[model samples]
Target: MSAPMPPPTTLEHARWERFKSKLGGWSLTTYGILAFAFLYLPIVILVIFSFNDSRSVSKWSGFTWAWYGKMFQDGQIMLSIWNSLFLAIVSTIIATVLGTLAALGLERYRFRGKTAVDSMFYLPVIIPDIAMAIMLLIFFNMSGIGFTPWKVNFFGARLAVPYSVIIGHVAFNTSFVAIVVRARLAQMDRTLEEAASDLYANAWQTFRRVTLPMLMPGIIGGALLAFTLSLDDFVITFFTSGAGFNTLPVRVFGMIKKGVTPKINAVSTLMLVVSLSLVVVSILISMRSGSEDSVTIGM
Candidate 1:
């Protein structure tokens, strides 16, 4: 039989516990720093190399704006950028309106099959982008909706705009906007709307005067989110882009297949800046609106 273990001395026990606690904290901090570096270091490198005078990304080269100039001069790249911007703007507008309406309907009224409807709206958020892209591709092919591209004349250049791609963007973006707007609606004070009704205000008047203004931040947030998603989207855009059309991401993918260059890095850096700016703006709007809500509730 084994002998019973002796109790640890109080002073020794305290030192051991302290050592373990410090070690664990240090390990976590180290891991966090390493994880962040691993994720973002490549982006930092890419941005830095975009300004490289030499084409090699791995070696340090004198700083220059040559890549940026090249990016601007490349007509195909410029066209892709235009397409991306156009898609983002149109999709954001369509998504915001439809999503806001959906949010209002879902939040304000009780309806049969509400849970299923809610799930359907959220499905896009949870679904994998590749799967959605493939599904969209198949649907567009079967429906023959996006086969013909609309030719738009832009400063003597005619570009084929794929309507199906726009439709797919709206389809996915609507769900995201609805989710954001629904969250804001959930936090809103129903009493304000009630007060409006008690004043004999019509539905349109009440919405315009009371709810719409209050919901503006959320609406803007959702629109920005939709715009960012549409701007950065690759998989869906690639699949639904049809023939003879390319968004920036698809263009970048094609460039990568051929070769990598500082010009590609420059384009990526610009996209990153745009995406981060949109996110920052959205966050600021949400925070401001949250603070306002808190103040209103306090009153």
Candidate 2:
């Protein structure tokens, strides 16, 4: 054939392959850096500005603790914080218990219309927050569920908190808890439970000793998620909370309507700290339990 077709140059081919590999790696590294910067830069800025002495959020004044002091002394802010904490604690506890039982029932038992029940449980998690908020508002108003705040005297300060807000939080929080617990249950090794049963253990005993321990990690994760969601909730709480009752998020919204300030920044930063701490704890628990995927289920 024409000069017997020159043999392919191995050196050139190797060089070209190496070039392509290097280019691909560089591209991936750049993308990762850019994505991280985009996500964290704003949070960093917020945290930094929270310490600014100036009232204006955009301007960076010399560092000062005045805002933190103001945040602590502000009665409205402090009261809202307490209300948020109370609502989160109550809703998380209720949601976790109900969600755990539901998960167990669905995973362990086969019943008619199980698919439909499961879908109904998932609706809150899938629906938009605004739509759910409006629906809850309409339902509460039509059903005549009292939005009246229960007035209580706490350490000399008069406080009023609405029970309807807690109910609304529980409604959505239950779905998240169920999803997380269900994911954990689905991934669990059934052999352990079977072994317990084979050893002549009763249903309650087997569940108490084995099932509960295994499920604890997921339960904790779900509870933390529920607490975070309840603490951060705005729309549902806003719609369900009657006049004069405000959680931290609702309080923040009202403040925003007035205008943004360093005081607001301080409140936001504190909230961010709490939320981040809860998320970190949940992640750690999931990692320790060898069920990293459980953390993402609620999300």
Candidate 2 lowest-lDDT run of ten: 1-10
For each of the candidates, the C-alpha root-mean-square deviation to the true structure, in angstroms, is 4.6, 4.0
Candidate 2: which stretches are off by over 4 Å?
A: 1-8, 151-158
List runs of model 1 lying over 4 Å from the truth: 1-7, 153-158, 291-299
Give the top-scoring candidate (TM-score).
2
Error of 1 at 244 (Å): 0.9
Give all TM-scores, in the order shown.
0.89, 0.92
lDDT of 1 by residue, 141-257 (tens): 889585567677755556677888888899999998898788788988989999999999999999999999998887887888789889989999998887778999999999999
Instruction: Extract clashing residue pairs from model 1.
Output: none
Quick one: RMSD of model 1? Answer: 4.6
| Backbone clash tally (model 2) | 0
Per-residue lDDT tens digits of candidate 2, residues 57-172? 88887999899999999998999888888788878999999889888888889999999998989899889999998888777777766786767665555667677888889999
Alpha carbon lDDT of residue 147, candidate 1?
Answer: 54
